[model samples]
Target: MYSPVQPMHIPDGFLSTLVSIVFWVISIVVLGYALKRVGKDLGERQMPLMGVLAAAIFAGQMLNFSVAGGTSGHLLGATLATILLGPWAAMIVMTSVASIQALIFQDGGLLALGANLFNMAVIGVMVSYFTYTSVQKLARGKAWGIFTGGALAAWTSIVIASLAAALQLALSGTSPANIAVPAMGGIHMIIGLGEGLITFGALAFLYATRRDLFHVGEAAPKGSKAIWVGGLAIAALLAVLSPLASTHPDGLEWVAGQKGFLEAARAPLYNLVPNYVFPGISNGSLATIVAGIIGVVLVFAVALGVAYLRRGRKRSK
Candidate 1:
């Protein structure tokens, strides 16, 4: 039984055209604001940081850990990005990741991309930012406070994202609200624990080693070659480990399956690295690694390009 690498994203037919169009409008407005905000104060060092963060998130998404009841989940990375890059820049990075996943990897449906962007990039990132900030204020910025904030923020983001997706499915009449909400929301609660732990551990590591990275969003330090190199190295390492990711259905897929809407998923318009396997690669593990590495590079390039283009626009004004 060969399972496609479907993450927590809605496929094409799952969303009605009207619903999809509405989300597209909303996503466009929000992302346009994000671009404007980032452009206004984009720094030289921030370019590489954006690229590195995008690459890291892309690679991290490849390693899906299994949750209970035959479901799987991966790091949404919205909270991590928001904490490190601010909400605006984090939105850019997350949109890049989601776009690449849909257009290149075919992980999600093209028609449903707007909804995905809204769910993960906008709602998830915003929820994470506010939750973390509230916790940080309560703890007075202590190490324990930051770590707690990151964990809680990450968990809440995932749950909220799932709820948004569930609402979309219900509104589309793909699944009833009674079934969709509970099924989508319940399993994700367990899945969110994994996200929370990963986020907490990541924050703890950074707090121990590179406390200055936290300041990159406010006044980024001058570009450091070592940081970029180290960042890429970490992404590459995650790609190398992508082969070991669990093959179970993610929250969305599992809910779709249980609710009898899994068959509504449509094939992508095109295939670049379909299902995270490189072309002409017989070995499954090797092919996944190759595909993952390529995804990392592509995401890095896109993020850097966006950063530079925005900076250029700001200078021209």
Candidate 2:
């Protein structure tokens, strides 16, 4: 489902330097605005939840499963975040996770961090959030409304992100539109199925067990047996399923290969914790599991720090 090192992340050379820089500027501006406004109006109570939800997203990505045709994909969790925390908070959380993945885990390239965030964080959240809200409006009162909204948004996020990446790669001269678009779009359609089902299932689970958490200002849902089960399930996936996940490269990597630009991907400058390995973890399976767990914790701390800072600002002002 994941290459462990690269998943859907755009590597350094995949995008032109100018394109990367442009996205960096855009992403930073959006992130700055989100940090100042996202949860500020909701009060500080929802801050810590940013960390907890980011951890769940990190864990969920590690459990990527097969879709079809030897291709696989992982969760972006943008819709899930938007559903529980609103669009602004969801964008901040996704950006935080992507930044951490690029720097600490080397899951994405430093130069391309902007593009990565632009694709998976900004675009993913915007498309999913709008889609979910529109669907929710039309499907009100039905038990399936929430789940269907989640599924549609999740699926669209993947397809839209994939198309965006393909266009960027073409503009960067890494791949031609004819080859890149069709290949990327086709595979991601299947991958989106997995993302949609998982997202819908997750939404259903949350609504049933943690409905209090649906809105940003409400009290945090108390930890129940279901919460424990969900936590354990996430842990089990990292410890067990991550190691057993399909070894094939995910959708982006596969498309790169098919479009004859796989080698266009270059390594990051420092490669800190390259391939998500904790230096000296020689066992491939063990490294994957350990790396995933470490990444989850790292992102958790990052989100927590951001939340704390925001809370402090609110308290002072």
Candidate 3:
């Protein structure tokens, strides 16, 4: 199942400042690698769509669906993005979403940013992309192949990401393998099922309406203005619906509760403000909504900035 922060449910004080800082560095390095992989082919035409995808993933993450026993998990959207934009680009987009969630919403820990990015961005996009591609080829591009590949990729990414997080927790001495691994893995398995279904459905819809969008070959049609518009509309819809998402604690919290490490979680260093609430935001729902709005703008800005920078570099050459 998908874990929090994988979809941005990182609570206060989940990791040490040192661990978090280290991850931040790792994230930067991975992001740089992703940019180089993306190269200059990311044209102006892709900027708007990239922004829309960022916002959509951010908002989609907010909508937590109920899992078994009232536990809930949200959509990861990584597989869908990778399927649409290629894995390398999806890494950039997902990292933007994760970074914005940390800086703006304070939803994820600053120190753990790199670990979160590694799990959600690196694994979700890159690893899942390859897995989905393999599955697609095995299925020979049938509808079921796309559906199954999307589902399995989403599911596997969550489990892998959870393992990564668990290892971090164990290494930090905050948790033991007995507690961290099995609990995180067990809950996420359930969560990943929901992730799989949502991915399958989204891919199915895209395939039905715009099959050309999924083509990952030289002969594929260039993305059109319509795709950008459609993507934005979807992002807007997800943003509007984010407030109605599940409020239940995610897999990590649930695991913490079950394993008795819930109280052991340390507070983050950046908790200068009470409850880490952004100024002028009282209700959690309002704060979350505002964060989602800010995330849309930030993601759009970052994507456009990266695109233009790359474009400029290309023109100079």
Backbone clash numbers for all candidates listed: 0, 0, 9
To one decimal, what is the Cα RMSD in angstroms of model 1 from the true structure?
18.1
Error of 3 at 70 (Å): 4.1
Cα error, candidate 2, residue 138 (Å): 0.6
Better of 1 and 2 by lDDT: 1
lDDT of 3 by residue, 220-310 (tens): 2233233234333433432232222212224334544455343345444335456547455867798899999999999999999999999
Model 1 spans with C-alpha error above 4 angstroms: 1-7, 64-73, 216-317
lDDT of 2 by residue, 1-317 (tens): 44455435888888877668878998788667667776465567667888888888887888777757776666778888877777777887898788888887788899999988977887777777666766766876465778998899898777767766766676566766657666666777777888899898888898899877666334332222332243234333322322222232244345444643333344343364465455557678888899899999999999999999999999999
Q: Candidate 1's residue-wise lDDT over 283-306, tens digit each?
A: 788878989999999999999999
The 0-to-1 C-alpha lDDT of every candidate, in the order given, reads 0.74, 0.71, 0.68
Give per-model TM-scores: 0.66, 0.65, 0.64
Alpha-carbon RMSD, candidate 2: 17.7
Give the poorly placed runs of model 2, Cα more than 4 Å off: 1-7, 65-73, 216-317
Top candidate, metric lDDT? 1
TM-score of 3: 0.64
Instruction: Write the candidate numbers in order of decreasing TM-score.
Output: 1, 2, 3
